[model samples]
Target: MPLQPLLALTNSEPEEVECPAPAPAPSRPLTAEEYFSEQPPEGDIGRPRHLATKVQKFKATLWLCEDYPLQLQEQIMPILDLMASMSSPHFAKLKDFIQMQLPAGFPVKIEIPLFHVLNARITFGNIFGTETPVPHVQSIEEGDRISAVIDDACFAIPPGYKDATALDDRHCGLDDEEGLLQYAIQQSLMESGTQDDQVDVWEALRGARPVTPSPRSASPNLLNSEERQLQRAIEASLASLSVGPQQAAPAPPPIEDDLQAALALSAQEHSRLESELMEEQRALDEAIRLSLLDK
Candidate 1:
């Protein structure tokens, strides 16, 4: 009777308790690749979550001279666009401004030039959306006055041009590279304006000129293929200019003397520029070496 009563009392068995399995220990410390592979949680990742949705607008004014050629302007616009679109670590701070203030898909866009004839201004609108267009010239009168000043200061006659209209559309095309070079030469000479003391223009031009191998011989060891090609192009351009239609009338004694002097000055300037360029190249190479060492 006692055995039956005990058995009947414990009809239900004790409930089994569940336990979690222990986490397996890593075989070794995770490599950098493995550690970075596991993505952080969305909330943990820090990024600009709230930004302005509307596109921002900005304007930049290029105070080019009134006589600045339309073809040059067209060429310049694309260059400006290219410069703006180029990626640079220097522009890191602009990231937030670009994302929040600029147009949604395009980070940067230099729109077509807007020529304001009344004020003689070229406006390049951008999506920067920060500052208003700077008023370089307040009125048409001011613009006219500025233009007059520039003309008087910059565009004087050189001994090379026998006719006053030589600088006009009749002489230099301003469309072709040779014409551009001639135009530049004329402009430099004009700016110098028979001032014996002023060698600034020639020196500046010489400094700005791209480095290329000598035209007489191909020094493959000295210059890269690209440089050799550039040298050839420069030589061809110069050759074309030399063989181009020339005035039949001989230059006067004084003009001829002046031309000879100019040529001599240019030769001296070229030698000085070459020496300076070599020094600069050495300095640049040293800087690169130091930077590599630091890295």
Candidate 2:
């Protein structure tokens, strides 16, 4: 009986279990340094120059993401962080920024990195929740016509910045930064056109004609290093535009002789019509006279 007890056997089979690949260590968000170090992502040939640009680019991607694609949600984090970081410097330089005395059309040349408008909204939503007032816009035409206002709590916040401190409302003698920002945007949009002369720039770029390299133009040496740098940047951009891939060279301005010929032909046609009308009037008069005589 003791020898037979050892013959008992179990039918258990080995099974392989795959556990979610350990979630890949919850990869960390790219820090600001790592992000800026790379050449900005494609389609952002020129670096982002405004706070509204993220809202512009991500508005379609953001707003409400309850069921949005995982890809878009993944894309928003770095952008959001970068926006939060960039926002601080703008606030830090508020005194100096205001002093720049930027033209009403400042948006045309300058960019507004005012604050992370979406981040502010998200933060507000999390805190104030449904109490957060969404604008009651009853009308909208363009899908891009989204508008978000930064609440009073968000003004000049030094988010993602430590060395930078926020300017106090009473201390700075200003609580109307929102008004100031809106005024600036409105004035600039009105004075400089919707994109602040961006359309003009595209028009300039797509001139429908070839551009020849111009000789270096003279500039004031009196300009400070910063001004000189800015001037060089403008010149470089213009130079690039000048050398942009050539298309048909504006169909060679109609030859002066040809323009004159066209004008002459038009004038001749006008004269002939006038003469024909006069002749018809005379013929009608003659017919009326003959009819009366016959009567």
Candidate 3:
């Protein structure tokens, strides 16, 4: 079947053929473990990634608002760290306490403003007379003090941001009570020093005798007024214990007896103070409840 091929008469370019691109491979859905184990996106390490997004945003807002000096910022680092590392339930409790302080129907935007007020309170609230104590996570008294501070600060916020509630007449009473208690303790220590040539309650509790300061080593001028006063009181008490050369030293009590007596006195004073504080706190709570009801 050999046949002769016909020749093309005209010169024509060969037609070009177009081929379609192949479709992309389908992506498989990740398992729960794989998704959960994935790393966060880069540059978000500073954020508390374990917390809910809302809390993260709140913390970010707080960070932006904080413009304190480096020294003060450093001083508050422990508190800030405690807050950041708090468990979800603990944080929720803290947030609830904060909310309880706010007026009803206040906008959610007030949270940041309210926090600004709170930060100011924490900055200035040196209730301990010296540097403010860093609150422990599990201390009930510390928790109550924080709540009270928040309550006071809530009232201090500008009225334009939210409706003003009646300010508690006995606001900051806990702080006042604490100051009074410290003053009483100092007074009791001074009196005890004058009555007997024994170690003061503080030194006894610490299981050490007070070292008399050398005349050459005077207190620094940098000490605050309160600290200066305390130093003077200690010096006066020490001076009263000085024995005259002519007077014979009386037979001293056993060290064990003195220590036991000091401890017992300290325990009694502590119990009394605690009872007083509890009573005052109950009164304050009732007052606050009534105030809220009136609104």
Candidate 4:
């Protein structure tokens, strides 16, 4: 019986046991909620308004990593998201965006978000300190500068927003919503200056001077917001002339020579004046003495 069982085993070939390959996973479609909810690892959601402020400036830092630093990349996500989301609502009409012939292909999708809080109907006088209503857009005559404030909300966009669409041609194209907003703001700012008694806001901010309205003038507010921006840019350029990248550092102060020269001049003047004063005093005393003697 044992020999018969061994013979049967020897004649039979091992059964082929085939394991089926695992099926591929189906990709889930990305929903709008998911796109917006994907917060940058640093949690940039609640503080966009603060981030929008250009006050806390930082010098650019260079890195040579093959991959972007996790920290730096994470920092820009919220800004990008904010810009993308905000522009979506107002400029969604591609009619203009298309005619603009955005550099990137048509139907370009910007993954970023716009700042919701920053969007508002910005009227000139409505925003500035005095609420001096700016004349209607039509009322603005050509070449006349107008004075207006960026509605509090317009100023609410975060500075890091520039980082979001930097790489996207579609987003970077002038037709994109961000570009349109920038163009509009720059235009508005420019139009305010030289539009007749327009206040130079760039100067006020830079010089830390209080803003005062310029007197009305016959000059048309010809300069668009873009032109105004250029003016500011020029001013900024001029302001930096003393410390430009190309300029050489000034030689050390001529401290010793200046001090010695000042001292020498002071001494010479002091001696000359002292002698003259003494002579006058002596003459006065002699006259007083003679008067007393005569009396």
Specify the highest-TM-score model's number. Answer: 1
List candidate 1 segments past 4 Å from native.
1-255
Quick one: ranking by lDDT, best first? 3, 1, 4, 2
Give per-model TM-scores.
0.18, 0.15, 0.17, 0.17
Q: Which ten residues in a row have the lowest lDDT in candidate 2?
A: 1-10
Query: For residues 1-295, could you state the per-residue lDDT of candidate 1 as single tens digits?
Result: 0111111122223444433323333546556775677663222222223333432223332233333212332544455445546654223323222223322232122222122222122243321222343223221234423221123423566666553212255131224544444433543454465313233344565665423322212333422432343334444444554663773333323323333344334444545777899999999999999999999
Q: What are the per-model numbers of colliding residue pairs?
A: 0, 0, 0, 32
Comparing 1 with 2 on TM-score, the higher-scoring candidate is 1
Q: lDDT (0-100) at residue 75 of candidate 2?
A: 47
- Give the deviation of candidate 3 from the true structure as CA RMSD: 30.3
Best-fitting candidate, measured by lDDT? 3
The residue ranges of model 4 lying beyond 4 angstroms of the native Cα positions read 1-255
State model 2's lDDT: 0.36
Error of 3 at 172 (Å): 42
Q: Per-candidate RMSD vs. true structure?
A: 26.8, 34.6, 30.3, 33.2
Model 1 / residue 121 / CA error / Å: 34
The lDDT per prediction is: 0.37, 0.36, 0.39, 0.37
Tens digit per residue, CA lDDT, model 4, 167-265: 333222444444444434434444456333333546655665434432221122532332444444444434455586887644422333433233234
TM-score of 2: 0.15
What TM-score does candidate 3 reach? Answer: 0.17
